[model samples]
Target: MSLTPLNNIGEFALLERLAKLINIYNKDKVIKGIGDDAAVIKPDIDLVQVVTTDMLVENIHFDLSWMPLKHLGYKSIVVNVSDVVAMNAIPAHVTVTLAISNRFTLEAIDELYEGIRLACENYKIDIIGGDMVSSNQGLIISITAMGYINKENLVYRNGAKPNDLICVTGDLGTAYAGLLILQREKKTFMANPYYQPDLQNYEYVIEKQIKPEPRIDIINKLRELNILPTAMIDISDGLSSELHHICRQSNTGCRIYEDHIPIDMMVSNIADEFYISPITMALHGGEDYELLFTIPLNQYDLIKNIDDISVIGHITDANEGMYLINNIGEAIELKAQGWDSFKKEE
Candidate 1:
């Protein structure tokens, strides 16, 4: 099959083709979409709007050699939607912007947008508007997601108080485990161009890395149970780093028991193969996209039976400091050692 170069198609024709791929899920809320100067939406009367943006740059955030454009596009939406879910909101619309080099074919762009469209379909969101521009480097995807929540239901990183139980939804560290598997396979393939990677056993971890889904179900479950988190954050930057954010913002300390931290069996097995501690992955590995939150201590019984949610620790007085209690009854001071975009690579 011949690949049509992006330059072969005029900008207007490209836009027309892209516009047809999007389907507005909430026509009642959206007044305008792709063709407009800016998308128009009717605001919810009683709910507050939440907006978040995330950028994935080639060679920095991802590598085209290993990362499929569709998966990258889907993940870009998931990452931003996770933020809205962290605020206890329902994601409604998104605007996708792209910076593409001439080397990428028009078909490549279609594959990327197909992923974006899938995400929008799954999340019941609308692709309202976005911009595409030429780039000299490589592809860059910037997505802005919008969500809405009632004022009373809004949760922030600054709301945790003493005696609030620290909770996290779903397993931790799986994405990083998946990333390790991908990197290992990438190295092997690079060394021998004809080598085929045996990835049947690593499907779970790889999917977590390439196509993570935000814990929107957990948000709905919390609402259904009538339980409101005092503070909440998505575990995008690892459990330890996210705990620090909640503690620092809420002006409280925390103590998380290592035994209480949830790690999937697959993640544990992969960590063993890598000769790395599973606990280390759980604590410091980023991009889980699970929800880390805190609720009043009295509400522990309310969430105890929920299989996916784990109560790992509790909030404490500001002077107590953040700590992680080991199985041996030792307390170690917790630190934010997760993903830092500006931190120089050692």
Candidate 2:
């Protein structure tokens, strides 16, 4: 099959094709979308707006060797949506921007947009507007997500109080385990081009890494249950790093149980294969995108029956310091050793 180069159609034609792919879900909220100076949005009168932006660069954030453009597009939106949802808000709109080199074909760009459209449809979000630019290097994706929430429901990182319960949604460290499997397969393929990777057994972790869903449902569920989170953050960096952010901002300390840190069976198995500790991955492996939050201790009964939510620990006074209680009941100081964007690559 002959591939159509992006230069063949030019920028305007490309935009026209992309605009056709998008379907605005919140027609009442979006006054204007694509093909305008800027997107016009109708704001909620009583709710506060929540906005977040995230950029994914090729090689730095993803490896195209195994990462499909479609999945990359979906994930770019999800990472930003996760941020908005972390604030106890439902994401409503997003603007996607892309910088691409000459090497990428028009068809490749279409595949990426297809993934974006799917995510918007699933989340009931509108693609308001965005920019496409030429890049000297590989592909770069930047997405800004917007949402609104009632002032009473807005959760921040600095609202935790002593004795509040520390909770997290879904499992942790699975994405990092998926990354490890992908990296291993990539290495094996690089060393021997003829070697075909057998990845049937690693589906769970692989999917978690390639296509992680934001914990939007959890936010909605909490609202239905009338459970307000005192402090909240998405576990994009890692469990330990996000916990530190909450503790530092709230001027409180934390004590999490090692066993309570949820880890998937597949993640533990993969960690064993890699000769790494599963608990270490749960604490420091990034890209989980799950919600970490705190609620009053009195609300424990409301969450105890929830299967996906785990009460891993509790907040404490600042003077007590942050710690993790091991299985043997020994306390270890918590440290943030998760993803650092500016950290020099070894």
Query: lDDT per prediction?
Result: 0.91, 0.92
lDDT of 1 by residue, 241-326 (tens): 99999999999999999999999999999999999999899998988899999999889889999989999999999999999999
Q: Give the lowest summed-lDDT range of ten residues in model 1.
A: 337-346
**Number of backbone clashes in candidate 2:** 0
TM-score of each: 0.98, 0.98
Error of 2 at 10 (Å): 1.5
**Where does the lowest 10-residue lDDT sum fall in candidate 2?**
337-346
Q: In TM-score terms, which candidate is top?
A: 2
